[model samples]
Target chain A: MLPTPKKVTVVAGSGEGDHKLTAFDNALLAAGIGNLNLIKVSSILPPECELVERLDIPPGSLTPTAYGSLVSDVKGDRIAAAVAVGFSDRDYGTIMEYSGHCSREEAERAVRAMVEEAFRRRGMALRDVRVAATEMVVGDRPGAVVAAAVLWY
Target chain B: MLPTPKKVTVVAGSGEGDHKLTAFDNALLAAGIGNLNLIKVSSILPPECELVERLDIPPGSLTPTAYGSLVSDVKGDRIAAAVAVGFSDRDYGTIMEYSGHCSREEAERAVRAMVEEAFRRRGMALRDVRVAATEMVVGDRPGAVVAAAVLWY
Candidate 1:
């Protein structure tokens, strides 16, 4: 079996760039997680994983992450992204991601609700929840917003 | 630095389900990879990684993968997905994914071309190339096609 991640961190950021992918890259950079290669995973936090304040991964390393992002090229368009992590007692946690043409608060609320729903569906009692969110308004160039739960060994 | 993957496998499958996500899940199961947690990564095969005929990962393990998938709800519609890996003599390889409303042959051609383009852009001498693809026709339920390069320790 592959080793489970021991540390996790939540981060959010927004940015504008020349193109949509670049905008996304810039948003990830703003979120302080642009250097590593991100492997996107579905919502699941292993049991006994610890929440950390920051990640110290090297460039080009393969890093597992759960993220939500939105990009828009239309000027003045608002975009938001958020991620929520729900913890349970002595069991695995759940992660939820959301992105939409809405406010940061709305995105956060939606992701939290999704986490709660996931916990309910699993019959797990939700002990705590943590959220991170970001919003961006497009300017002359493409804009993007990203929120992520980064998991590492 | 995080440990790099040492083994890789190419797999493809198609399936039908009541919904899109389940359709995708069924496709993964058909491909023999549904039980694990997939971490989707961008196009890169680590240097010196060996190609394996199959993966032997445990259930619920976090498996890194590069993949392409297509889902269709319209009855009689055709969906195809393909993934290609281009290898260099002693350097990291490139992986390309493509999905479209086309035949499996067309999808395979497209993905292989993308891998060639990637090699050309990187100024790398391509030593070999491998591809996997799948196609599906939608019926009463939603249908999905998936092609993936599974990476493991």
Candidate 2:
């Protein structure tokens, strides 16, 4: 019999040393992001250098929700700093020119606004997020993970 | 836009308190057959039990892999475990019996044999596994996670 798939949530731009979050923390393994600030400062690692290779192929992926003015409404509470993972600038451009309903520019602007607001709400800065890795989940279903991870933090 | 789903691998099983596994060691979460002795104990949880209930639901489910099996083909030192996970038992059963051109019992038997071989190859026994909880996922395309998790460990 086929076993069902395991669910994955990718948190965007979560630092490389997320404390209290080691795999042993909750018997949970993580993708690229980490934040180990709570450890003795000496134990802390740079976000960019600390990236861990994923155990296997990146699973399925989802286009991240555009961060926008509404970001304050959605992630103002829990997020510190984040980046867009799936959606790209080209897609944003196409959406902006021909599609009046919503455009690529709109999407980009929304993401920018959300990223800023999320950071501001947490008293953080863009530079604080040193690296952004595009999580490519290649398989039958790919997009949900992008959403879950961003939403988690 | 929809967000992507991330794939993860977590082994869940119920824990047996005995410092050493005895033949009588029984797991609260295990549902299948196993000898009582030749036991090695670990603290683990069984797969989620609500998998069946959740599998039948439509929108989203927390049920982990509803169907799981591992078929083996071992010739001498070449041992392999063919793993599969499905949305539910019915979904897997039909494929095994009809599309796969194998009897239902045979498909199941193949999986069991392969799984046993896998344990043997790892120098582990079936009785050593202590399942904890089944992690579940629900989405439009949930196949990759299923495959990744099943083949991972």
Restricting to chain A, the TM-score for each candidate equals 0.98, 0.26
Off by over 4 Å in 1: A1-3, A16-44, A53-63, A86-96, A103-130, A139-142, B1-4, B13-54, B58-62, B71-76, B83-97, B103-133, B137-144
Error of 2 at A36 (Å): 24
Using DockQ, give the best candidate's number.
Answer: 1
Question: DockQ for all models, in order?
Answer: 0.21, 0.07
Inter-residue clash pairs, candidate 1: none
What alpha-carbon RMSD in Å does predicted model 2 have with respect to the real structure? 20.0
For candidate 1, lDDT tens digit of each residue in A1-153?
368788889999998899999999999999999888988886577777899997899899878898999999999999999999888896778777889999999999888877776566557799999999999889999999999999888
The candidate that wins on lDDT is 1
Query: Model 1 over residues B1-153: C-alpha lDDT tens digits?
Result: 557898889999998765554566578878887656687889699999999988897554688889999888999999999999898998999999999999999999999899999999999999999999999889998888999999898
